[model samples]
Target: MRAILLIDDHAMFREGLVLALTQAAPDFTVHAVSNGSEAIAELEAHSGISVVMMDYYLPDVGGSALLRRLRQARPGIHILVLSASEDPDDVHAALSAGAQGFIHKSASSKTLLEALHGVIEGKQIVPDTYAAIDTNGRRLPQSDDAALLSALTPRQIEVLRLVCDGLRNSEISARLGTSEKTVKAHMTAILAGLGVINRTQAVLIARRAGLFGKPN
Candidate 1:
């Protein structure tokens, strides 16, 4: 049986995941831990760890640093990040740090198990919303201009993303508690920054390039 290590900060989330995964993949032996530090300790105690499902919001250490440390310690261990949503930057950073894949938190138990298996088999899985970025055990972008995504500030990018989602300026302003004019201004800047002509171009660029919902 393949040995899987689970790392998360919340007791309930970790336990729920454990129960779900155990039911789905009965042949796997799962070793659960609460954080990155505990993961290292577990590794020291038991060197047979094969796969690690980690969350980014741990108290002791976040997923990025934890994966980096894990890669340094055990290069063969398959690392997958448990994330709430498809975040471009998070997926990029995790894979850049040597994670094998990303599993969305809201995925069904069966999907999670499948993702674990896929990771074990060395496939980089991305959710439906993030299409531009590709993974080959590491997140290497298809285009270097995609790196310019970081130029826009977080909130500006957030508003621009809503526009890409086809949300009107009024709806965005209401949801974000900002003025319609403010939303329009952000959209203008986003278009200019991306060298796009309009909102349609911006949205297409964002989705095609995996620009939205970067893990914070």
Candidate 2:
């Protein structure tokens, strides 16, 4: 039997998901936990766990941080982020943090099951909205673009521009005449400043804020 772990803070939502998954795949075992710590404990105790479905918000640790920790601790386990947020940035951050897939909480049971199955089959799943952003490489700025841009430093903005252009850390460092370590530092700060968790999210947020200037 396949085993899956779910981590989310809301008891009602978690219980509902557990019930839905249990009914959908009766042969498979589903376990639910309410926080990162409990999720970690469950993972450690259950060696049969093959996939982890987690929420982007946890009471104990941020989603990205928890995702990173799970990746490091169980390198072979597949993780799928199930979040209520439909924000492109949140989806990108979950994927960047090593989640195999990202699905909105509002997704239908069929879609949710498909995502879980896809992750178990070694596929990366992203919602259509996020996929569109990835394909377009830019988005129109929202009304709050100015406020978001103001939070980032000029150097951080430069780093973010390269990131939006799909440059890796090494390439970014070379282009800026800086070390890769410095580039990473800039990325970290950029994520923090933008209230994002990863490069893809930062790029998405920047693009939507008109930081890339009409994509041409």
Candidate 3:
């Protein structure tokens, strides 16, 4: 069984997630805490926890700082940020601070499960829509720079578009009727062709290049 810890300031939200996670995976051992301090205590008390799901806003500490502290304390445990904000900077900050993934609170239950599983498997996860938002939460305007777009194959463009639509690799695979490995291959090519290091950056570049029809 997998041991998971959830940290959020709101009792209602934390309870709701507990129920949702229990329904999604019955074998998961979940512990919930309402603040960063309590979360640290919970971590100290539970040595078997494999993952920590945290909200970006906490009453006692900022999410990113707390994440950094947790990473320093327990480098092996995977930490995932669950935030309601769709700001690209927030996503970038959390991941840069050592979070394994950033999950929108609005994600469907199935998507949430997939994200947790992906993180447990040592994968970095970010919502596809992060590409559409600038640091100030404004949609990036389309650019006339077709140089990057022209370099990509049609199939890679297709994958990139779906990535902008906020689909995970597994979801993209189902949509394209391909295996996840094939989707990963396409992503690798897309990253190299775009000259970006990660999917989020690739999507942002594609959006700026007007590769996608409209910004979400």
Candidate 4:
């Protein structure tokens, strides 16, 4: 069984995640800690941990600094940040400091599990939304807009254009003569292709790419 080290400050939330993870993945043994010190201690005590899933905001230390220390302690260990922070700087900092993956706390359990598996397999997983921005929270340069626009299918482009027009999933479904579920799937694909996290980001990127006109 693969060992996982889970570090978060909240006792209740940590316990809840422990229970959820235990039930969801029986093949993994989870070691839980409430702060960065205990996390370091746990890491020193156990050499079998395959992944470290940590919260971004902790009372003991900043996320990026702690990530560096953890990486120093266990070189090449898979580290995944599970935080509620959607800030581009936080995402960039954690990854630059050696985190292999970052998952928003709002993600479903299934998405979390997939991220865990991806990290374990050495994939660098981050939300397209966060990945598309720089550390300063600015969108990436306009030069890549052409490439990004070219990556989408014509149908996905239509869905994205409708999205830029401020259409909801149901509205887009109605406009495209497709089900809401299908529109959601296309939106998901568009987000992944565009390296964005939400409809707003998608619209911004599309506008920058000249795939859609700017709002009045």
Candidate 3: C-alpha RMSD after superposition: 9.6
> lDDT for model 3, on a 0 to 1 scale?
0.78
TM-score of 4: 0.64
User: What value of lDDT does candidate 1 attain over all alpha carbons?
Assistant: 0.70
lDDT scores for all predictions?
0.70, 0.77, 0.78, 0.78
Off by more than 4 A, model 4: 141-216
Q: Total clashing residue pairs per candidate?
A: 0, 0, 0, 4
lDDT, residue 103, candidate 4:
89
Q: How displaced is residue 59 in candidate 3, in Å? A: 0.5
**Stretches of candidate 3 exceeding 4 Å from the true structure:** 131-216
Q: Please write out the lDDT profile of model 1 over residues 1-216, one tens digit for every residue.
A: 878889988899999988987787788788999988989989778888888899977889876788878766776678778988566667656655666567788888878877777767655555554444343333334464465667888997788655543355776798899898988888788878876555544554564555553221
TM of each candidate vs. truth:
0.61, 0.64, 0.64, 0.64
lDDT of 2 at 123: 58
The residue pairs found clashing in candidate 3 are: none
Residue pairs clashing in model 2 are none
What's the residue-level lDDT of 135 in candidate 4?
Answer: 53
* Candidate 2 structure quality by residue, lDDT tens digits, 176-212: 9999999999988887877655566666566556556
lDDT of 4 by residue, 17-121 (tens): 999899999999999999999999999999998689999899997598888888778765888899989887777667656677788998888889988887776
Model 3 lDDT per residue over 1-216, tens place: 899999998899899999999988999999999889988888888889879999999999767889877766666678888999977778977865667688899888898898888777656677767655555566654454468879889999899877654456876898899999999999999888876667666655764565553222
lDDT of 4 at 214: 30
Candidate 1 ranges with C-alpha deviation above 4 Å: 133-216
